[model samples]
Target chain A: AQSVAQPEDQVNVAEGNPLTVKCTYSVSGNPYLFWYVQYPNRGLQFLLKYITGDNLVKGSYGFEAEFNKSQTSFHLKKPSALVSDSALYFCAVRDMAGTGRRALTFGSGTRLQVQP
Target chain B: GAGVSQTPSNKVTEKGKYVELRCDPISGHTALYWYRQSLGQGPEFLIYFQGTGAADDSGLPNDRFFAVRPEGSVSTLKIQRTERGDSAVYLCASSPDPAPNEQFFGPGTRLTVL
Candidate 1:
């Protein structure tokens, strides 16, 4: 089984400032991590995923995440936040070896508030 | 490319009524999944279909929920005797035939039970 945890319920950041959304995971095997963003009345949009690559993975809308093996964390980060970027963010994970098993487990979600 | 499409963007019905939500996966995609999203929560997996068969339904709350993916393209989720707790947005997503691929999501059908 695999599970994800978004430690913060909400994160506030000023426009043009850097921001970070924390995410941690627990899985029976090696983890495949993903990040998704949801706008109001919209579906979850794929941001990025960490399968087998570098620790810092860049994604759409200038977002990136660091996959830390030791800490078991895959935190989303941005150099300069945008007010339009305010939305709900989710972190998900699946086991690498759960081939026939479901490959996605999402966190509770973290609300990102970018103020001007 | 056309993303996944779902029908009945919004549905409202009284308790004990039955509802069906539809989904059309991206063209040629072989993996379809159904997920339910409650208020202030992330989407929870309901079922997964590989081709025309249901490969997983572990997340389904009970026997009242059923889904089908005949012909391996379009899928429908049927809920019977709906309760107030069944009200939520149902999302459908599809990916390629293999694992570790990104899943495209539909706009989702908001089912509200009164």
Candidate 2:
């Protein structure tokens, strides 16, 4: 079964400091990973996805994630954290080799808190 | 241009009652999905629809949960004999055809079973 694990329940960072929200995935075949953000009382908004490409993939709102094949990790990162960037982050994985199932398996989620 | 939209943003019902949640996918999106998200948990897939047909329904918890997309645009999820455990936020998402695309999500409908 394809699954994602977000080890940290919460991550705290100061504004202008680099932030990292960790994510690890387990899948049978190639993994299609995605990062989504959700604000309070709002739906999820897509940040980026790592289908197959370079290890580093940049996404919206100055966010990026590095796909480490050996580590089986895809950690979301930001060069400089902003207070407004604080939100709930979710890591999801999909097994490309799976049959007819396109739904993504999501992680428990990590709460990012950027202090001003 | 509008994103996916769901009706009855908040619904409070008594246990054993029937409730229907509606979802209107993005214009021209061919794939629609229904997911249930409990408090402090990620959304869990319930069903998937390609056009007017249900391509996958394995994630549905029980037979009491039913969904239909009669016109391939708007979908409805009907829960019969709702239990207290059924209280959660029901989310609907949509994506373009051809599979493996970023799904656009709606501001889920919060169902509260008393």
Cα RMSD (angstroms) for every candidate in the order listed = 1.0, 0.9
Just chain B of model 2: what TM-score?
A: 0.98
Clashing residue pairs for model 2 = none
Give the CAPRI rating of model 2.
high
Q: Which digits, one per residue and each the tens of the lDDT, describe model 1 over residues B29-80? A: 9999999999988889999999999999898999999999989999999999
Q: In model 2, where do residues sit more than 4 Å from their true spots? A: A98-100
What TM-score number comes out for model 2? 0.98
Who wins the DockQ comparison?
2
Error of model 1, residue A63, in angstroms: 0.4
Candidate 1, after superposition: displacement of residue A82 in Å? 1.0
How many residue pairs clash in all the candidates, one count each? 0, 0
TM-score of chain A of each: 0.96, 0.97
